[model samples]
Target: MNESIKTPSVTDEASTPQMKTKCEHHAECMKVIQAILDDQATEAEKDHFRENIDKCIPCIESYNLEKCIKTSLADKIAKKPCPKNILNTIISKINS
Candidate 1:
């Protein structure tokens, strides 16, 4: 069987994602990015973010930065015994 490989046309907008020239919703996108990075965003929100992230430079940068920071902190945290007073309070609350 013979087949022809189709090349994407330069003028095809669907083939190429238009890079955002200006980050107009930078502030709102940052909040969404933070929620996404922190595992707090809903699936719909995440889907929206995934769809648009590559098109927005600022949001992608924020997502990378926040992810890096969270990973670093998780690595650096040294687990220790909980404070006696706080532990007691938590236990009491749980028992109540």
Candidate 2:
């Protein structure tokens, strides 16, 4: 079996073509990203993002940042149960 993969040295990386730092469609990408994350994206939108994400680093980073924020909020926020007294009062008022 093959062992560990070899990472390029700093010098080797420096000599290669620079990775793209900007994406022209970043704004549009963000909108599509929101739709996708919110489960509102059409199948075509999902396919488009999947096709472009590998080449567009800016969009990829934005997607990751948005995902992290959503995940953190979901995991950290506490859910509290309503007090029984309040629940009883609301039910009594509705019945009357």
- Candidate with best lDDT: 2
By summed lDDT, the worst window of 10 consecutive residues in model 1 runs over 1-10
TM-score winner among the candidates? 1
Each prediction's TM-score versus the true structure: 0.67, 0.63
Q: Which residue pairs in candidate 2 collide?
A: none
User: What's the lDDT for all of these models?
Assistant: 0.83, 0.88
Per-residue lDDT of 1-96 in model 1, one digit per residue for the tens? 446876667778577877875788888778888888778998888888988888987777778888899899999999799999999999999999
In model 1, what is the error at residue 91, expressed in angstroms? Answer: 9.0
